[model samples]
Target chain A: MNPSGLDKEIILNAAEEAIRRFGPSKTNITDIAKILKVSHAAIYRHYENKAVLLEAVTERWLSRVSRPLEPIMKENNDPEAKLRCYLKTLCQNKRSSVIEDPEMFENFAILTQNSKEALSTHVEQLFAQLEEIIRKGMETGVFETDDPREMAVTVFTATSRFHYPAFAKEWENPNIESLVNSVIDLILNGVKKRN
Target chain B: MNPSGLDKEIILNAAEEAIRRFGPSKTNITDIAKILKVSHAAIYRHYENKAVLLEAVTERWLSRVSRPLEPIMKENNDPEAKLRCYLKTLCQNKRSSVIEDPEMFENFAILTQNSKEALSTHVEQLFAQLEEIIRKGMETGVFETDDPREMAVTVFTATSRFHYPAFAKEWENPNIESLVNSVIDLILNGVKKRN
Candidate 1:
């Protein structure tokens, strides 16, 4: 019998929880199926194996988290505003309020390796979008950069500190907003103080 | 029979090679013994177990690599010069020229966790030394920072990108020196363009 739409969603949610608890290395299909109160075969019918199931879970999470960026990227007429919003979203999401689970972040390295084509496409799309914003900002004399792609990568990498596990304790401090703003200002205006 | 000094060194070297080749997860004592042309019991005499052998190997590697920093930290009077030199050394030694094995880099993460207390103490001492330099710079009105410890962490983290695997390919370019210099400049002088 074909699993219902709800069955797939339940299985995906169970898999996400299992992977988070055990990491990609230790997680198994049986563990996920048991968590869902379903048979392992039920999961195999919906998804081929644990790898594909984990991949689907990752794709689902990315879609959910990245959805808000679509409207911000599309509707904002000003490239600088769009870029600032994107950076803010990335930094601010470090807080508990914005992120429901921290474990979702761990799967990215494994997911990136296991599904290189899909992950690369998604990352390339993000870089391309950021590059477009940088190009527009340069044309408007808002951003000073000779190479937009390199600058985009630099910006992305700098902001990635928010997601790093090492920074989680520090991110809880009250001054996190100011710290994030300082980092953003350093990138946008350069760190050299204007005389 | 006790292994000779030469035999012990050979076993340790072979174990290092095996760990590098197979990674910590797959490496076995027998594999190391086979590589060294010795019985596995000889390795047990020297190391007690694989874990202890790995720890010794890691400690040996760190001691050899970190030896140069001692003289610079102790003899250098200028904090900035010491900091700059230390950072340059860190970036330069990302891959040990003497080892000629890329696998050593991958095996290091395993060793870092294997000897947490020793590694942590060593890192703490290094950070403390860096913090002193930062504090001295601030006192001399050469460095602009309210919190020397936080500033040290920021500098260390940002400069560490030079040693990251992701940046290894890009670092081979002739411009990497200038790129690292720019990052240092930004940390010390801020990034804003002067009028």
Candidate 2:
């Protein structure tokens, strides 16, 4: 035993770097141990297994993504603008993350590919944020009446092309901004109180 | 050279069956020849290369898909009905194709993955069909005014989740039909003429 004493934070960092370098399937706890200069047992103490470590890393990523949106969600701005900003920011965050480090993002994708429950939790958080804005709009007579939870899902699914990583290749197109704007307008017209 | 005389139709049939059995990458011209009881050179005589053969198979698949939609496009129904029917049929066609034999669909996906040009041609045909309906709607004042081509594209992109093969896993959800109906409601609201 090296007995050098490794923390979970340090192990998480090494795991992320290792995934970036080797892709998901090739990355392993043993590799992270090598990077951390500790025994595999030491790493295992912090993260019970590969799946556990992956979930932790994914949770960290989701929290980082959620941080910027909290202000937009809590702000007293018009619900329409808040909803628009929330979606635009969400799309931008995903697109930029994919573009900034494509290889790393690809590895992350493989790691999360089968973790349906983990990904679903992240989406549930998004739905909750959207539902809040939707509910407020419905209450203030600014938007049409509908189930806030359902409307939130419809809006999110409607703009899937812009925000979904599967469609990220299309994000680089010059017309993507207008496409997002057009979809937003379509959704607004759908949701707003129409006479 | 086993010049037993193979036609393009025969070769395409063999190639498609081969792809379905072995997937795209694992499938090769030699394997197709083995299936056909002929020399690879005999198969090559009809198609210049594997890329050419794959494109032929894709074109055939796309044309088969396009056949059912032609009647809906040509029908003199209201533009709104036409648009709704067109999009619904498109989504159903895709979902069924994915569901009926997922393995074949998966193999087809691999064959067509990198052939962006081939797939774009199919989408262009879909767009053209959609644009026609939108133009008719605009002329009759039944729908809101916009560039028909642009609006057609927007509608197609917005409804991508139901139709795109990437989300095939979600197709099994029992609520997918209702989700689709809600989206159609949203699109109609977005496009219909307002007072």
Candidate 3:
């Protein structure tokens, strides 16, 4: 990459780090530029403002995190297996993303307000993608849900909250795998005891 | 009530509102004093500092919210009923407390230190109160569970998150009640399909 391109990359990485440390509200362009050993004007050349830079960082973060799900979502034929994989992927990876990068998550929240249309568009796309997998499962008779959209919402909500216990103020047991399994089973098989 | 006692009540309410609006970091004693139409020095007479004022506000918030459960919890003879009532109480009441009172809950995060010790102390007290109900249900073979503590945590975490959709983002569904009921059912009965 050219020197300018390298500088931009460095600036973006430092911005992400700053967001992680000070949260979205506290992080500023000067802070990021200072950490990057570059002028604030140089950052402006690459990005319009702090908002734009934050949005780009959030986009990068989501793309990186969501990338792993694409393969399993595309290739997997078994709905149950796919659902299991999705939960496991979240349990093993997504949880760490929040715990490891709180600033990134907070930055994402702040950027969402700045660019509501863009944020909503991306959110709608994710929800649609999730709903498609759920609809497929319902069509295959692997899932017995009456409302796939609602079920999708419920499962996604429960799984997302599982990752961030700080916000929710509740946590599963240390046996995370079994906790994941039990929650997945509850969703898959409607929690009514079997004969 | 004595005039001094009434002034204390007024001060605490104002403090709670200030904390909720500005968050713990931004809220100051001057703001609370102004809101209560009292001298800033008067606040210092009752509480040493903002931190002390915040702790008192949080303790008051907890006591207010937890008070409603006391009757349902104390009166309930059955473990399953007690657990169900507890879950219902949390789902119905905890939402407003969290939503309307951000500082109160945020202060909880500070008090709890996001550790099992704080969590266990609260959960253990709740569990002990529900122990007889759970034990009686287990003895009668109504509830089939080996570890009530783990089950209590699971129920608490799931039900608590079920109500707070904004935090999770995935729970923006319209039919949240049904969704909550489904989770409750799954927990009460195991999720395996019945014959």
List-wise, what DockQ does each model earn? 0.18, 0.71, 0.29
Most accurate candidate by TM-score: 2
Lowest lDDT sum, 10 consecutive residues, model 2 chain A, at A1-10
Model 2 CA RMSD to the hidden true structure, in angstroms: 2.4
Best by lDDT: 2
- Evaluated on chain A only, model 3 obtains a TM-score of 0.74
Q: What is the lDDT of residue A70 in candidate 2?
A: 87
Task: Tell me the interface RMSD of every candidate, in Å.
Answer: 4.6, 0.8, 3.8
Candidate 1 clashes between residue pairs 3 or more apart in a chain or in different chains: A190-B191, A190-B192, A191-B190, A191-B191, A191-B192, A192-B190, A192-B191, A192-B192
| B1-195: candidate 2 lDDT, tens digit per residue | 245667888888888889887888788999899989998788888888988889888888777777789999879999999988988888888888988989987777766676778889999999999889988888888788567788888898899898777778889999988888778788888888777
Docking class of 2: medium
Rank order (by TM-score, best first): 2, 3, 1
lDDT of 3 by residue, B85-125 (tens): 76677666655555665546655555434243434555566
Candidate 3 yields a Cα-based lDDT of 0.63
Residue-level lDDT for B193 in candidate 2: 79
The C-alpha TM-scores of every prediction are 0.60, 0.93, 0.65
lDDT of 2 at A157: 90
lDDT head-to-head 2 vs 3, winner: 2
